[model samples]
Target: MDALLTVVVPVYAVEGFLETCLDSVRAGLTAEENAAVEIIAVDDASPDGCGALLDAYAARHGGLRVLHLSSNVGLGPARNAGLAEATGRYVWFVDSDDRLPPGSVRAVLQRLRSSVPDVLLVDHLREHPDGRLEQDASSPLLAGPATLDRLLGLQHTAWNRITRRGLLTEHGLRFPAGWYEDVPFSNPVLVAAGHVEVLNRVCYHYRIGRPGAITATRSERHFEAFAQYDELYQRLDRLGAPAAVRSRVFTLMINHLLVVAGNDSRMHPSCRRRFFRGIVGQYRRHRPAGHRVPAGPAGLKHRLVAANSYPLYSALRAAYRLAAARHRATERPPAVSPDLSATPRPVQTTSLR
Candidate 1:
């Protein structure tokens, strides 16, 4: 059967959670949709048993195709390989450590086939360590045509959206090779796409705080986020994107810098220094006209960053830590579930660098 949708899952060291993730993909579809769905699982030279497990599943499944690379390419190149091989009309990217909720595939496919939009944006539930689910609330604002101007609030992860393969090819879009690859790739996709739709349902289960997960662990690689945003702005400019779209991306860049800077403990001094310098460079290069710093601590932080004031930046970090400690002191403990242990963990590996 010709696949209506192709799911591209780039697997690395995700052996501990791959089975559950694949299981969710299997169970999420209705019988008919399952038959029409094709899964392309790319094993980017996983150091563990993930490749063998994917091959085993492929051997038993009719619509599964497993690709094993000769060497460990990063996630971006692995996804490019899968995208090149996909034959489905529409393509969806999924992470090997995450999964789809039950009935999600069926519901998404129903809407997808009916509307056949160039890009389909959907919501996700963040699954915390204690088994709590927090659904993202930005989908309501995405209903109309003005979504490109509001890209910062949207989840930029590739898997949360299903996009037409033709649209990607038309725009000559491919992921950049780095930690913050999604920002460059996703921002352009949303900007170039003509027909976009948002599904307000929480279709994906995104695990947060899992050990060894990219978001859970921090490294100097986090600093790569600045370069990624620089790429985004460059791409937007080359493509002649509207000023409003460019402004939104610039704001998102600012937000990303603040996020990395706020984690003072995880960052080395050298990394922090580079972060401040890089953000200031981006602000000067990309800050839209009429953008003013609002009055607040955040505004002060932005101002300090603009001026490249190291002492004030350090002070802000200290203040942020104190505020966070107070908040933690006042917060109640999370409700723990008995099945928390059942939740899977990502495999630990240092090969991404």
Candidate 2:
């Protein structure tokens, strides 16, 4: 039988969590659904025994397909490899370190079979190091008159969303081979899609604060997010997007700047001066004229960055860090893992941009 759904998992050095993630995937699908599902796990040259583990599971499962990369190609390329091999009607991207909630696969398959949408969006539950699982907060875009506006406003993570395989292939949309690649691809896909379904249910369980997770660590590559924003805006412009779309794109540009400049605490100290300079330049290049100034702490940071005031921006970032620390301190320590259904996922996504 033709597969109804294909789950693409890009595996790296996730030996500790790989088994749990796979187990969750296996349990999430019903026996019938399992027969109609294909799990494409691309082992990205993990130095650990993850490749072997995946092979062992593939040996036991009929629908499990494992692809091995000779060398590390990062997350984007690894996903690309899986995408190339996928043959299901719908495609869902899941991180190797994350898992799906019980019955999620069956639920997703039922939805797609009933009425296929160009894209389907679901919520996520985040497991924190402090042993708390929280449901992700809902975005206004999820409940709106579905339009390009809503899609642009949605988070850029590949998870928590499923797209019709044809939609992606027809548009020739693929992740870029670098950090923050999701931005350009995800934004354009949402805009290009004709129909989108937003389900408020929590389908994916995301783990946060994992030591060695790409997002938990900071690097100069964080700057790539700004480049992605530029590419997204350029693509929208080339596609002749309307004023409303352009306006939202401008807002995204500002948000990306703030995230890279003010939010990234792991950024190298030497890169701060250069990063701030790039932020100011991007702000000038993209800020929409006559746009109402954003209000709130974020608005303040935006203005500071736009002003190109190094001292003030630095101070504001320091204060933001302190506030975040104090907030964390108030939460319970890492005692026991919270039930996956307890609280909602934290707003933090792989794409902080």
Candidate 3:
């Protein structure tokens, strides 16, 4: 029988985290549940020992399958290769650096059996470097509505959504190569999905600030975000998505580009001006009619981009950073406090005087 779910993990230089990731999928699954799910790990020509490790793990686990590629094709294409071989009703592209939480597989299976949605969106926790786990802020939105605008507002990650294979194949929806691949792939899936459901349970644990992680690394490749958004806009146009949906996507595109522009870790220092220029061009090209920018600092950023005022934006960013530093300093608690017990008494000062 064909499996119900296919979990495609694209492995690169993540040997350190691969075992935990693989184990998490099978951690709490019963034999029948395990049999009903397929796990595919693609060895994307990683320079590290990931390939050998995958082979060893697959040898030990009868159900695990590993696909070895001759060349490194980045994360998007590696996932595509695994999807091509998937034999499950639904497909999930999971990153090797991340892991599913305990009972996550069971939750997903239960949902799939009951709902059979074209797209099943689940919640996730973001694991920070300091060992903190925080639920995604938009988790509540999942239960409210399954509209494309609401789906777009949620986190734009492939791993959070388990999609019906037929929906993807019918729409020719595949991840494109390059950075910000999720932008193009995730949005289009949400737009194309006819029946969507949300699983409010936290199914995945995403690690943040990991060393050598793409989001934490500084590179000019981040500029690929522009091209990816361009592809997404074109796809939406072809799909004849509603005007509101397009406008929402345009807002999200500007917000994402601004985030990349502001992030010190992702955007190189030298590329700041050029990146701002890219943002300005995108704003002019994609900004919808009568679109309302978000409120507060974010809204201000949208206005700045619309006006093409990079210099003012730079100055405001600097001032905001300075004020934030000061605010943090003020909010810090005292390192040490006076101990009243350790202090000497007045010692009958009145009598002594």
lDDT of 3 by residue, 1-353 (tens): 99999999999999889999999889979999998899999999999999999999999987889999999999999999999999999999889989877778887888789877888888777777765676567766766645566778887889989999998899888999999889888878878877777776677888999999878999999999999989988888877778888889888888878888988999887899899999999988888788888898889999999888989999998998899899998895332111211222111100100
TM-score, predicted candidate 1 vs. hidden true structure: 0.88
Best by lDDT: 3
Q: What is the per-residue lDDT of model 2 for residues 200-276, given as tens digits with 9 covering 90 to 100?
A: 55677789889877577778888887787788777667556667767777777677666666545546678887888
Name the better of 1 and 2 by lDDT: 1
Please count the clashing residue pairs in each candidate, in the order shown.
Answer: 0, 7, 0
**TM-scores across all candidates?**
0.88, 0.87, 0.91
C-alpha lDDT values of all predictions = 0.76, 0.76, 0.84
* Residue-level lDDT tens digits of model 1 in 42-146: 999999999999988878765689999999889988999999999888999999888887777786687788777777777677778766866455544454443
Ranking of all candidate structures by their lDDT, best first: 3, 1, 2
Off by over 4 Å in 3: 327-353
lDDT of 3 at 262: 83
Point to the candidate with the largest TM-score: 3
